[model samples]
Target: MQEYPNYQDIVLVGGGHTHAIVLQMWAMNPLPGARLTLVSPQVQTAYSGMLPGLVAGHYRLDETHIDLVRLCRAAGARFVQACAHHIDPLKRRVSLLGRPDLEYDILSLDVGATPARDLPGSELAIPIKPIGHFHRYWLQLQKRVQKTRAPMKLGVVGGGAGGCELAMAMAHALEEQVYSGRVQIHLIHAGDKVPEGYPLLARRLVARELEKLGVSLHRHWPVAAITEQGVRSASGATLALDQVLLCTNACAPPWLAAAGLALDTQGFVLVDEQLRAQGCDNVFAAGDVASFAAHPLPKAGVYAVRQGPVLFHNLRAALTGSAPKSFRPQKHFLSLLSCGDKRAVAVRNGVAAVGGALWRWKNHIDRGFMRRFSELPIAMDETPAKRPREIVAARGGVSLSAMRCNGCGAKVGAEVLHRALEKLPAQQSAYLLRGAGDDAAVMELPQGKLLVQSSDQLRAPVGDPWLFGRLAALHALSDLFAMHARPVTAQALVTLPLATAEITQRDLQQLLAGAVYELNRHQCALSGGHTAEGAEMQLGLTVNGLADPDQLLEKSGARAGDCLILSKPLGIGTILAAEGMGEAQGRWLQKAVEAMLQSNAAAADLFAQHGARALTDITGFGLLGHLLEMLDGGEQLGAALIAEQLPLIPGAAQCVERGWLSSLQPQNAAAYAYVDNPQEWQKLPQWELLADPQTCGGLLAAVPAEYAENCLQALRQAGCTQAAIIGVVTGAERPLAPVHLLRKADWRELIAREAETVQS
Candidate 1:
């Protein structure tokens, strides 16, 4: 809890349970002058303990997860959802899979361990240790079981705890179905005992559970090779399995070994008592992925959770000028395990027992752990910490706390941008009124008396040029839909990270092609713009559309008593922020990206037909931030939103509950300072997600109250799955910063019903 005097950056590289706890501690007692950043590939971190429950249909996806985005946001850290591909120790940079390299003064890694797959033909095998991916595969197995009623044999490699759990869970799930007896379960381990590493009593308990599930167990056998048909054991025994799962012997990520870090013989990062890399003080490692020379511990969630407090302290100490603290890992921690049939067993200090109450206890503990991430409250520290020395040096001590002015200030620094744009020429247009000076250039209309225009830009957090181009193009077009302007012509401004000419060309082509695709979808002409190599990646656009002046849509057109409609769900901002940090889940990330890539043209079309009054796409700013713009344009107005009614991308609210939020989330929350009780806002996980800034987000349009239902129906029919009638505009209820906030129960019920209907 001690505050450091100098600003330093602590970059955590996973969204594991340990890091989630670390974030919570940091939120309560922040290290002054330190900027915390989390990198992960998922916005939602699955709780391993609940995997069995989830498989058994006892727990929901939202029940057993951590919101990496919300956790980072609550901790006042930047969350980047990106996978770590390599680490440059000399450069102090962590290079991502296909994004920009991240610079950190001090780094802590808790990315967890994966099952070893170095055996021949391992690619044909399934890994059960990565619970989330395995969960999806398990779902496929269910479908396969149903499709083929013939006898099917399931093989599990590695008699460890994970393998035992999966075998039991699979047996329970498959047996409950009509094809129960047709499904055969086999458990193979290199050792004689099931759950070999646990105490004798615990091992015996698991064995009994497997016996009751009618699972066949093989001992002292290792797989020599895995094939499409089956696996070959070293003992010269061949086992035919319809599905084979491997869940033994955890190994550090391959990238870590290639990154040149000092590792153990097994390839885990070697760390000292304080979790600092054995030979590198600036880098630290932990979880199942790390090996400690002084105190080696098994890869267990309990150990990871216990290490959090010590890791947080040591990380700050390493950045500032302080001695490292020792992390004394316990010799034995309690292990509460499930048997996939509402039954459980507890293993602690060599004692073991099983009972129904034990399962309840386990569920309580897991839910409690998840609740920490799901029910976080937001309270910003008024006194901002000073900038880090590196950032100060980069900025020459210039102020950077506030947003830069738009017109000239938003432009790149004079010397830097001038040289880049010099090679590019302005477009020659007879109707061009202005080129590049004011907020946006003025362009006269054609004979039809209608004009179409759009603008967009992206500050790169992660990902490569190709993906960035597509995202930028989609973002730029949001404005055209907001104004209900017809797509006609478009241009782009691309800024790329410095690289060779070959890289530049590839970047430009992909970037523009992405823009071109969207423009062409609307039949708009891709005229031209500007491109330049720079220190980082940024893309923007100035688009033009055509419409009668009288038909032009504006934020000022919202009227009192109108219904507030949101065309898409919130949470992309938080998810992307988490993705940059490498804490986001791979599946959740795919979903977020898909959502961002979708254009709002369909929703806009539906809203226009529904008597849309005013509209603006929610971006950079959050829901309340954008809503205020609509309400305050003329006479003051208030809004009563059904907190549950607001449409949100799946898992976003859970991320908020876990305290995962965008870097802009706190800022958006600050803009919500007008709200009297922010705690009330915290109850609505989705409402808290409203502060999550979106990339290519949907339009927030005001529609006539009379046509609200019809508008909603039209939107649904037009394929706007997330569209919803969130609330109604109200007269101003006294002057306050929060002119709008959520009404929890109503919103929650509506959304729950919406989810069920969609599922049905």
Candidate 2:
């Protein structure tokens, strides 16, 4: 492992082919004092070279896509799963759609292009760029064609290699499903012939292949508009089609034009031969999004791949103040086009050849390129190169020759922490008598009000210190919300890894800033706590709130006939655990983080308005454990949890099925003994998720049966999109069982019984 102090930040805007290559290279030979950050909208980026094969059912989704999340982890880079909204070149910051603006000393953009959608009724057609979205739509189309026996008409726009290849691929896929005779396929192009830019032989071969596949070729035709019935060409010629796919001229993202960067006529960022953004020394651009001003090249994946090594070299040069080498693209390159079968056509310069052997060669090349990123070199354990003794002494007084401690030995020095604390802003409150300096913080209580307290701590699940702190504070505050109390103050308990005094102080500031930001959002004052060094990062918050005696909610007030409402989705525990092992996608973890950061204050108020009888925040003990606490050996009151109705995070069920669970899951599963009628529900993959411990989870409340729907609606309107009425409380007739697991088949019966009980 490599470590650097006070490193410079390098932010990569997208996980394109070039950037993906750069990340892998950096992992092998990392810059000594540079930190890398990758910002991408999707966790998996598709390889364009293999996309035609994927459409033809020759490849699986996972086989053609690179997992950016796992790749970043292997590269020791921070992965921000968010869309890049804009760039501030003057300020050196990249603004994301739903997160904070990322500050960078160096910035790079490798976001690929999308099809031109400015034509009339273009939104009605599917664009092939932004490959992730296209792949999902393609899957749905495949399922639709397979299920229905009705005839379908499909049109492909554009005469280039992509458009031609896709038309043939779609035909091949439909034929495989035995719908070839019923489905009509059209390849529409503005040019006079298919494969317009290819050699004469390649063009003739592609034309012959299209004819063999029974695909109609509409030459010298440009689409004027797309309607529900069909496509209307510029010459008043109309073609009836059920669906249209546009593989027309690729265009730069709209955000690039809005960012005020120097762009070419087509709106792509202009870059020099060295791949540096024109007129911006600290910025670089590559892939389909960049236009090489000196020697222009076609917007192809091959050019992007060729530019990777140069971009990587130049980026390092910019960071270390070295001269960058120029990049010169070859005048001509070989192009291999898959014929939607086991054969391919290879064209280079003015020569062309066709054979199954060519297809195999292309397959080997594409797979080998993908393997560079997918199968990264295993990291080896090697001793650090010896540094001067004086340099080691200046850093922390530890000898460079000595091995670092594993546990408490990795903690920071007490004197170092004390010095860091002096630089922090003073946090004083009317409720706090003595500030954070003493052994403990002292606080005063308001007259005639009850004190509500809750404490929570956890090891950092994310690499960002600020994000971890914010999550920690939110986790603690969730308890106050469940109790229907107003948060007044909080004390932080932070543990940081051993590092230099400068690095320690910097991390401390970021951690506290995040915690304070969340605390101040609720008008809660920070009353200081304790900080110490540790083997790993951990953050804990002890929150104090004020509650009115008459309005306070408790776990003991749950009634037999109440409706059980969960304010958020479950399965976050499984998601986090999967992420730790690099088995989770970036998008799933992103959703989990957003859920954890949401404050439960509004949910609490809504629960109270809906006449909730009992409330508790789900935490480390899992939903079953917390619900069991409410049951508490009551003989006359029991609960029924509907398995299908439970709200779950997007990929949680899949993770559970894969046996990815939190370390504390076994302890929480012990409460299964309290369940009376498990039935076949216990065999479900989601069954284990009930015992999965959550961090900063949602509130579980019991409300009147009649108001359940209304409460759920209000919660959804208030942005708790996953909120659902999972089950209902039942009157216990059998004393031996207090909990019941209801499957989908038992839903109607349970509802009928509840209705009769209410009527009685």
Candidate 3:
């Protein structure tokens, strides 16, 4: 009888070719009860095969790139856009650049090797291993070539296949652009031959290709250092060149060797025939980043690609408590290399060089491989309804959708939270008129100045501590700014997760650094607060701000006909939710994080300068919910919102389409039911997206109709480009129309009126 595969998680740590194959295979024939995840720094993975062709101006960037976002979506794998810092074999976790530890039952490492060998000033020199960086550098070089009409001297380090190809490609490119045979290209190598490890015939073909491209080759010469002049060899010989490209022997990222995993002499992970890292049953590694201890082979893409299936099967075997299948790597594999200008060189066993037709054949293979990722679209197969027994069992636990508690219970669910906030009553003082409850509570001044106090807490559901800290500081300061008060002092509340003493200290230092950086930027003096131990990390701030009685903008001053303006785009909550599930794109998520970190200090300053009547920052409560609160407190004013004019972050509509909403979305949407056309309003994507909750979000204010444009202009100059007039205030009626929803036509008219008024 076959053993049933138990539920397990198989995490692929990189978006290399091997992992791409793994994702495709997993999508086609998924292993029962196995959860798959792919983690990388970017959503797009460039096909190395088409990279040379791209540089030669044959293929467009998108044409030569595999969309990891689309591929992972198709595979039903969690795709996290983050850089891996290290692995903790003992803890069965992989640490990330800007997020929490990702635990794995079975981990596969297919992260390709980087060019990090011992070359002096290597940090200053560019490494060709990170193709993303190389692409940017190459573009810069092309612009330089176009701008500088003088003869150019370029140097290529390493006589390896990659180095040779880039040298010829650069030379060919420069020749096309400059029309000057004055461009000189030099290839420097520590080895005696161009393809030192390959058969001599293969070397001759590559040598011929290099000569054809007019690349001068220097063999048996090692570079000791790279300088502005050029590469300096160990024998004290320096090759002069204007630009240097380093494509030396590929070495594993040094951070990997220190990750508590068994490593070979060259610092690659030591794996058995089964691709399992030595002495670590749950851990596995592959590609150029891994070395077979028993039968070590050269770092090559073919081996990495071959290991994917074996790795997949072994992972399933490990999950189901069965014996793992071994991967016996072949003694030799076909090597198809690209020469500059759409030509190629193929080497098989003892046989050697072939071009033209062979290059076409290689091109077919490369395009075919890329099509697996690019051509296929993700179609999520409907999950079969859970059986009665499983459904019953799932209902017994605390619901993931349970109503959140306030104060301490207001914290995120324990399972999801990095750390819990400690609940403590504010310290009592005679001078303290109010503590942490109200938005900018009143406080007795030390002298003639009046003080306002407010506080806020944030539980990070996703992303890193530094990012969380930045958002936390901004969130805390929003209360002061919303009250038209200048921030003066702040005290931090920190709750750290379970970790080693040293790690805890480092986390605290980093978290504080992030917070201090934001606080200092706004000139808020750092005061003392509290810290404690918890299962998850959290941050909060208790802040004091100063305001004169006459200039203060409370939440209660809106008059009838005041224009309602929102000083930032909506959908942060949707983005945050997507980020938690690893469903967000890297660039979009980066923008959201940047927006969250931005201080409303500047916007508030402009609001005070421009004579705002009333203000409130949009936070956990949706925009509609916050607007309702302002309506209740303001001067018997009702609101009529122009749904069409609302600003939103990109991808927010898709998030809503996919049912990715903030946990608080339901409550916020319910709050909008008071409006007559709430359902009709919900039909509009922007209005529907407005129900998304935000953390450290933008401000909403009631300004005079005449001054609204000036206020918006002030906001733009103050760095609030997303700011817009969203609605207008109205006199409260007997039926109590506190909020009115405008139809699409009316919304368009409101926006036009605002634009025309601004232009006039």
Q: Which candidate number maximizes TM-score?
A: 2
lDDT by residue (tens digit), candidate 3, 535-654: 457888988887788778877787666788898888888877775554665555656766777788888877777777888999988888888888886356677787767888877777
lDDT digits (tens) for residues 117-202 of candidate 2 = 77788888889988878998898888877788888888998889998889888888887443447888899988786787887888
Q: If both were scored by lDDT, which would come out higher, candidate 1 or candidate 2?
A: 2
Candidate 3 ranges with C-alpha deviation above 4 Å: 1-11, 30-37, 97-100, 350-357, 375-586, 589-593, 596-611, 614-697, 700-760
Give all TM-scores, in the order shown: 0.63, 0.80, 0.67
Give a tens-digit lDDT track for model 1, residues 288-332.
Answer: 777987667778777888888888888766655567788887767
Order the numbered candidates by TM-score, best leading.
2, 3, 1
- RMSD, each candidate, Å? 10.6, 5.7, 8.9
TM-score of 2: 0.80
In order, candidate lDDTs are 0.72, 0.81, 0.72
In model 3, residue pairs whose N, Cα or C atoms come closer than 3 Å (at least 3 residues apart or on different chains), thus clashing, are: 405-410, 418-536, 418-537, 419-536, 419-537
